[model samples]
Target: MKGKNKHNKLKPIMKKSMLAALSLGIALPVAGSLPHALAGAIEPTINISRPVLNDDIYWLSHSSEQVDALPIMPSMPIGVDNNTIIIDLSTHFSSDRFTQLGAISENTNVARAYVTNDNKLVVVPYRSGKINIQLQAKNALSPEGEMIRDNIELYISKKGDLNGDDKVDSADAVQLYNYLRNMVTRRGFSYVEKNQADVDRNGEPELADMNALLSGYANQSLGAKDNSYVLTFKQVDDAPYALNGKLNGDLKVGATLTSNIEFFDPDGDTPRSMLYQWYRGSEASGEGKTEIIGATEAVYKITAAEQEKYLFLQVTPQSYSSDRPQGNPVVLRSESTVAVKQEDIVSLSPSNGSTEVKTNAPLVITYNRPVKINMNSFSSIIIRNLTSNQIEANYIFFLGNNFRANDNKVIIDNPGLKYGANYSIEVSNDAIIAADPDDNAYMQGTVVEQNGVQWTFTTQIPQ
Candidate 1:
């Protein structure tokens, strides 16, 4: 009764005194008068002792594979503030005496808060953001019980603290650089680590971010405030330009011409595509030029229609990533105008069937345009005596002694002829070959026949 009688005698009296104080609008100190066991049931004032209530908390959001858990907490010195906060209770309530001890974060997505079994408040940050947490303690102070509450703000930031040492220093810079270059064993960066490494806040970790971190670290060492270092970047772009351009093939009909053009870009971008246009002009100066129809490739074949016309190639470089997609067009003309595809015999000396022929005159064949006589085929020329029914001269007789080629004519030294002889000159179809001077396009000579008869002439009778 001594143990039970004391508490039993004060229960009704204390309840009536609390009711009387409440009716008279006067506060009563019931906790002082109650028994220790009864006072322990009152709600205790919740206080966050480690981190000041008005001071904001900072935490590193970097995740590491080497660590045991994600969002690895920084290793702080003895006095440094950290994510863990000590929960303190009033004198009336002990740690285990509270009915309930819990914590809730206002923004659970950014951060979360929980109270450990030993009344330690721990904050787990997910990303870079701010969150407010309310710490609560409940006990049976009245019929419905009373709730004690306190709030603490948490600032979760990347801050380039990659090593989880709570400092953005050179060590963090090296780690971030190695991670970006894949020099680390773990090649990939976690979401939180990426946020931490992206010092410029451009949504991705890159070389620029690493450089920014270095600058930030240097500024921090110089007594600059936290997050005072900022970096801004701009993309550089330049247009492509032609270095040198020219036509690579012969400037004549029936020949293939190639465009030899080189292009360069100041911004180091390659040409995504190129446009080629082959033009025909009257002069080698590239004036009065007209694009050849259907000639759009890097190579163009000269046709018969382009004979005697100069050719020019215009190349336009194009790039998709350049600030100027289309570069200046480079126009290069062929060295010379196109020449005739084949040479044609325009005139014959001493007429086709002359009745009077001078014995000292040279036999000549002239062409309409300049031509290259195939010295290799010179042995095919032949002259026969039709009247005497015998060979007058053979190719062997006139190999180098009587054959001479001028600009557009082939001259043969006059062969000794008998007086009053009906002589005929027979040149084989391919004996006199005519070739273009520019591109070497050749054509065999046609048989010289006058009214169903070979080239026959009557030499003057001996005087």
Candidate 2:
């Protein structure tokens, strides 16, 4: 697969020109969209149908009164003949498939399918390895039916030709090999749909299929081609903490694939002898591709194609040493065909907020994405003081990444203050940061304030 480059592109004017056509007395998904078919070389075909926001099931695309996901598929596939991109999920197997990627925020849904613009099939690979969200959540989008539709945005790449034949092959055994290569668990394909190369046809992949993976050019001689190769280490504790983080791998495609790289500080708890290496596999049982880099430039580039490949990190489990073989491999996987140039940190909350707030209610801040913060990684200061600006105190609370937010409310470990007392909580100017090696720049520390004022809902104590 020849490497393909992707940059964010936008479309809007078409909907305006077709305003008359849109108002044909019908309810529609994003009626504002106009038919746009571009006949450019290797352009991705987009199936855009903004759903009826409040009424339809979130996952289904709706016309005025009904939800229709299929109909929502890109209207144009490939060319000038009312055809810009053509999709044949049936040709590949008749089974329909779609993908989504919202690495920046679990709350944000970024889905993608093979929608077309003209006659040519558009292979759109999403470039948002991560979105600009905060490490904390603030008023995360509603999780009703809209969420399902949002999931549809998961994107695939133009270069996912696993067979090396320059096409997505259903019958070819390479898709099987690629799938196996991407597996980080024994329960292969457990989370995804079935593939043609189930080998044993048990609906689950096994070592037999793994061998098929090897047979499909399993391990090959290493060379320059491997340079673009990279491994990833994602801290998936199910909780975003480092000790519980998992390491995975993927092929580096561009500067945008930094999520796959991490600093495996051997004794990471201590910074010296820091190792920045390309990691691979799951944390439970995998290995690394190279020695850890002991440099300060947190991110390093892996000059390779953005292909669907696998990688891992190698760590000496405390149970084992160089002289002793006591540990097992910890294996993890990447967001298939997805890589990051920098850790995907969307953004912090309160990008631009009012300088002051009501003293009665404590200020609540949140992020578009999650963050991994630690004792030293934090960039700002958070403290409390008497509203008159006299008493000052540092709760000295360390908020690591992984805070969750919804309904415009974020959870702070310690509101760390006396209720009804005047306090001004300030987020450091640069308080935003990534804590875990796997965390991106999506978190921002906030400054909240409080006052002695009591709520009307609360009864006042007798003075």
Candidate 3:
């Protein structure tokens, strides 16, 4: 293919060769080993030498908790940093990323989701069985994780209009029941009913469904005029700041994660406008003033805005009112410790568990503790394959640390990876800040355990 992109979203076909064997019983045709029937499918044996698989003992915090181990929920507004209301969705479905025909996903963000000030939920949607759902947050976790458990009870479902009364009802069972009789809930083709109908589907709108509808419908506030729709909140910190001044404010990212206020105007039938702004403040000498204003559509970076995370003080997308409240400020700092030492691996592209690396994605390097060095020199990052312990000309890119106003992290693109092979990502941090080339700012970092990072992921063709 002369001018075609050799990396045109390679979709490897695991050619069948023989039965595979695995301790976990996953038989790879060539690589993995499991004892099973021989359809004779051969997978490209990675022979990766098992790069430290303590699972939780290896890499990123989220991976350790196995957050992305399951499907996600859909029907959520990606961003929401408003001050007043944090929308709840536990009244309906059990999860966000659903493996169904009607599943939805956002182009940005995922796993552990956030609500942009504009009132849209950005999340990574996954699928299982015959349904698909969005992972309402950036990462997924099992029920045992302490952090994930605290918020497990949050998030109510948004698809319970059973009575056809333009409102959720107690008898939606009848609807599902009737649908099961003739109408299909899978939203599948004519034959889809044979595959997706709830002959034994997991909890298909059962008593659980009835109860959720009953509770939500029973609530009086829901009946009030001006129905409340989901709104998104976003970080708006790109406005110019003086040298060594604050960008937004002291924004905390834990249990009390906060977003500035932004409201949307209500249209017909819709209650409450989603338009508002947060209180803006200055950390200058005795500078204590705040105001309401519009919010940005997404998170913006303050590359030159000194070392402080700013939070929305007050939101006034709506008309001003004394009763209206303000949001908290956010002071940005590296929350996670950079455990990875040296440029151990940058995975120019999809090497380990990462799935969305682009040829132009920002160069995101993880470390054991927070890094305070400068990375302004190295022209870019590179992805290379390991054939006989030698670095091969697999792929390369120049993803220096160029902060974008609207991005939280940088993605490096086309660090060329081999089809069905393991590779190491190399990031010359010193090059990132090597002003004169000699002073490469290579900081001493730590290695996150295997569980800390997603070391593997499957790829799909660009549909």
Give the winner by lDDT: 1
Cα error of candidate 1 at position 282, Å: 9.4
The TM-scores of all predictions, comma-separated, are 0.31, 0.20, 0.17
Pairs that clash in candidate 1: none
Ranking by TM-score: 1, 2, 3
**Count of steric clashes across candidates, in order:** 0, 105, 166
lDDT of 1 by residue, 330-440 (tens): 777788878775535676776668977766556777877565546565445566666788887765423556666677787766777767777666555435443554444
Off by over 4 Å in 2: 1-312, 315-353, 369-381, 384-393, 396-408, 411-444, 447-463
User: Candidate 1 or 2, higher lDDT?
Assistant: 1
Candidate 3 segments exceeding 4 Å error: 1-281, 284-295, 298-310, 317-366, 369-380, 383-463
Per-residue alpha-carbon lDDT of candidate 2 for residues 5-109, written as tens digits (9 for 90 to 100):
111121222323333322433312231232211112332332221111111112212121222334223211111112121222222111222222122334333
Q: Kindly give the stretch of ten consecutive residues in candidate 3 with the minimal lDDT sum.
A: 50-59
Tell me, by TM-score, which candidate is best.
Answer: 1
Per-residue C-alpha lDDT of model 3 across residues 321-377, encoded as one tens digit per residue: 223222122222223221222343333234456554443333354432233334334
